[model samples]
Target: MTQAKATSGFLDQVCWNSDGLVPAIAQDFNTGQVLMLAWMNRESLALTASEGYAVYWSRSRKSLWRKGESSGFQQRVHEMRLDCDGDTVLLLVEQQGGIACHTGRSSCFYQRFSDGGWQVNLPVIQDPEAIYK
Candidate 1:
């Protein structure tokens, strides 16, 4: 679907969990492909909307983070969605500048387990240094 069609939905009804957070999944809008998943509290959500970028709550680091703050491969928010349960969220983004994966791959989903071994599915699309400082 076009971004304009995808963006017409409301973001106010999205249900935040008890901790005031929602699980946000970042997907490639054109391909309907998932790229990454993260959490966002009310502040982060608001920040994302106001800033026109994706802001996430880091469970591991217990902090707020803008995807690619250091890498410069930011995900610009094209549209945001709430699932039927209201517990999950979806973000359609225009990924800027470079690969989203820190491992030098275009995306994080680069591995597939085969019959007896692990296989790399996609190639690293861009060098991290070209975008990251």
Candidate 2:
């Protein structure tokens, strides 16, 4: 097979969603805490694998979002896994700066749905304005 065909086949194994995206989850390698969930396209997945860092498809920005490019909270990948159905990507990584959520918490899933409402479970590590500065 040609090189292009080979590359295409490799990525084709992934069951991309209707928008050509896959849900990627980054988990803390040491604590097993789920750091965040993001979307990834073929290009971002390839870049993340090649660079050993978390790179995601920014749906809001409509471009590649290099983790920590602005917040200095990058994720150094330790391992990557594809789900059995090939529809999900799991990244075991060391989260730099001990922060993961854009809201300045350690994880994006910081809200607990208890008491019939969402409650804050984690405190903000750093102000987003400060981090994004």
Report residue 35 deviation for candidate 2 (angstroms).
1.0
Q: Pick the candidate with the highest lDDT.
A: 2
Model 2 C-alpha lDDT versus the unseen true structure: 0.90
- lDDT for 131 in candidate 2 is 89
Q: How many residue pairs clash in each candidate at the backbone level?
A: 0, 0
TM-score of candidate 1 on Cα atoms, chains taken together: 0.77
Backbone clash pairs for candidate 2 read none
lDDT values for all models: 0.77, 0.90
Stretches of candidate 1 off by over 4 Å are: 1-12, 116-118, 126-133
Clash pairs (backbone) in predicted model 1 = none
Estimated TM-score per prediction? 0.77, 0.92
